[model samples]
Target: MSPAQPSAELLEAAQRPFPDAKAMPPSVYTSTAFLAREIETIFSKEWMCVGRSSSLAQPGDYLTYELAGQPVMVLRDQAGALRAFSNVCLHRMSTLIEGTGNKRAIVCPYHAWTYGLDGRLRGAPFMTATTGFCKDDYVLPSIRCEEWLGWIYITLDRERPSVSTTLAPVADMVSDYGMENYVECFRETHVWDTNWKVLAENFMESYHLPVCHADTVGGHSKLSEMECPPGLAAFNYHWITKEASLPIGNAHPSNTRLEGRWRKTTALLALYPSHLITLTPGYFWYLSLHPKGTGQVAMIFGGGLSPEFMADPRADEYVATLKTLLDDVNVEDRGCTEKVFRGLNAATARAGHLSYLERPIYDFMHYLADRTTGFDRSFALAAE
Candidate 1:
């Protein structure tokens, strides 16, 4: 049978052209069936950033993530190569690991089935007695994993292009930041009470900044000063150039390649499917999204000073102050998005017209439309 589809209103919104476009319909945010389609069609096929490779610099370091319906874990093998594998054990389907940590081997807690960091089966305490059983035949399923600019990405679909290929446009724009050298110093994981789309849309435009972030980062740059250009196949970015009034918002110590107003510029990006980042000359921050369901999203946030800032004596003070500022920003965003989630369910709910400043949002909707419906312009899906 053909898979279910998003609502007609939503499919229409997804295909709407920019400037004349409206926000996505409420059903898109609240429909469980549409969420299932997105999970299988979009999230399952995208090469999404999970975390920093530096966390796995040593052999045996591992971290866990739930991608779509799969329980996945990425680890460093004895040769220091990164590998991603199903975290489920072959024996009785038990989850092999609980959380992030260092381990010499993955041992299933239920039956003690052991596997190497490379995902090869090494042992099964009682499986030898089973007729025709062999450790070599029971390797943990593996997925495609790659690293780019310090971030580790994994795609359940092996046919997906290299993450670098998908991110090339963004890579060019962010190359001057020396991003691969910036180590992760602060990290946070949380499940927000909102749709993943709500959080992602919140970051796609600066329209709400003046009202939503008045006390923090709102007024630093006016909406007119921001630039939202078209994005490539896999991602989109907007430019924000402004001087800071916050303690850690000053020009970065390195002051290397950025010239003119760009010295104080920042790039906020949305990597289709669900990766968001804010890259600045002095520091960087990211929010990696995973939808738990229609109403919840798993958010992974990480930030640190730039490589140049890390070498300065004020690095400690700057990072500490930046962390606080980010925390405040998070608090405000959480409240705003959660309320928006509830508002999406209102009987009076309907999509509003898009603002000119929300160009990235329009691009994101196009990316979603193309992937979910297999057409760049619009999808006219019929009932199966």
Candidate 2:
């Protein structure tokens, strides 16, 4: 469990077959070096989920994020295209925008430099005096951004495959859910006092639900009813079938797209590198994680409803109820994940064996090893 050997230990655990697989070494969660390696090999190269595409429905609608220390902006352009660009201003290197809002133009707060919705430099005050300055010469550099099944994903690495290609398994698995039509109702961001992977691993499995979420989402959860199949190369997933604790967690009465067990089924998806989604029949919510060093994680949390529920007469009531339920769920998760981090940092902390219910965590460990240590392991798990 020495910090110096975390990657090697992680690789060994990641290569172990299921049922005999042990938990990752504690140092993997507490080591700064391991985290730095992940930032380079994982976050920099992976397709990161930003939020729902519906959140940027109008021209100039924008949201900003810091991806692996690089500021990025995703916005809807005047031409009705979803675009991603470097948020740093071209002239003075100041951030061109702040927070989420609809902007007529991207204007730098430090100077009067302005860019159009398409990122073309449009104006600069008193810049005529600058030698060899041409307004047309400056344009914010673009980053790769794509929309797959209603989610917006961006990446800094151009060599990475398209989000659609990488996450096709997820799309096909949830095809019946019509995830693209699920509208986003809200989005929020928070920084939690835990390693990003700790929060991610917590979200990847439901074994802790009975204890960690006893006051909120755990009441109706039956561990035996949850399915933890092996994960695909791009993501890991599990299923739960039950009578939903909330009405909207099941299909809305008007929904005709789902049949039989699917009407009451929910899919918990961990899209690698750090996008976790809980997609129910009538609603969906997700978390996009970014590490702030090894001790804190920045999270983008959001959720929304399917078309059937959105069109229902009690749509407003359903939204309110869903929001409150999610808030409660987050409170429980934060407490649980933070406690795990504290334990991970302890001198006596050690990894234990993984239960059958923690298959996703096992798959995730492989992903971490694959990225950080260049451990070549096949992750194309067949569906059971």
Candidate 3:
């Protein structure tokens, strides 16, 4: 069935209650069964962020990464179009690319078989003419790929919902913010020793800002002053702060750049299933989470803003400023999330429910639970 027709029962299930946010259950973060189910039902069918258009800026440029235990490659073809394919070779199931680089063609080191940028089998050095081998049947399998604001996303399930449908609300929001012209300045990755959900939960709420980020983000804006909007996916928290409020001496050295700007506000937007976009002055950054296992997650961060902003002479002066802000924020979060993950695994605490103040996070959990349980039912019932 179509994405627009998600079952009413599933929607209701998503809107149901869990425990409080502070007292979340251990199973949600540590259960192997839950993780496996998430991999199959959520990650496999979702539009997962893989890389950026800038990563494959030129034809023949390629980057390889894994999602849900499946090796995937993002590359630009000879025609300058972006494409994605399973990194596994059709011949013996060996991975095609070990890492990121530019290549004229993809050649499997296992047997020297080569494939073109378009995923068409190009050469088989060992095959004999009498083998009657046909290249048409041996092309590398392709995955569904789509791009928005220079970010690349891929899906393994061919029958899954379209990217446009899954991300319609997000597209509208970013467009309203004029993000299409945003240019990227930096991209970084952090691997945390925690369930992916832990990171997502932390992002969904601003309750910890005054305590955890007091030295960095706290100096710029007051947590109590931020505006929290209603609706789970429709609105996220936003805060505007003046640069003069930044603490130059006592604050984390990483965010020292905020000292110069007249004013800047960091607008945090959390899209369901692991997509986060943050808008700061002259730049925008995003983090996409990929679960490695029940206890680990890989966070890939990318930045973009109007290209014009990067070209401005004044923008150069703010380089150190932006670096410090992101560094402190990420480092602090990494430490806290790792600790939270350990706490969830401690076996003494029970699963927590969402508080009224954390309605957005509750909404996200509801959405996840609904999708996980209702998808199969909806599909089956529709078939009948």
Name the candidate that leads on lDDT: 2
Candidate 3 lDDT tens digits, 1-384:
222222332344343433323333466667676677778788888788765677778899988878888899989999999999989988888998976789999999899889999999998876767476887778788988988766788988888776677667766654534555565666767688998988987887777766678877755555555655543432344444444332321122333333432225555777668887766545666789989888999888776444445555656555556666778888888888899889877858655455555655655655565555553333322332
Reference-based lDDT, each prediction: 0.83, 0.90, 0.68
Give residue 370's error in model 1 in angstroms: 1.3
- Name every residue pair that clashes in candidate 2: none
Q: Which model is ahead, 2 or 3, in terms of TM-score?
A: 2
- The sequence of per-residue lDDT tens digits that candidate 1 reaches over residues 181-300 is 876878778999999999999988889999889888886768877888866667778988777665344456456666677677788989887889888877888999999888899999
Better of 1 and 3 by lDDT: 1
Cα error of candidate 3 at position 278, Å: 0.9
- Better-scoring candidate (TM-score), 1 or 3: 1
Runs of candidate 3 with Cα error greater than 4 angstroms are 1-23, 232-265, 351-356, 375-384
How well does each candidate superpose onto the true structure, as a TM-score? Answer: 0.94, 0.97, 0.82
Score candidate 2 by lDDT: 0.90
Clashes per candidate (backbone, < 3 Å): 0, 0, 22
Q: What is the lDDT of residue 175 in candidate 1?
A: 82
Could you give me the TM-score of model 3 versus the true structure? 0.82
Best candidate according to TM-score? 2
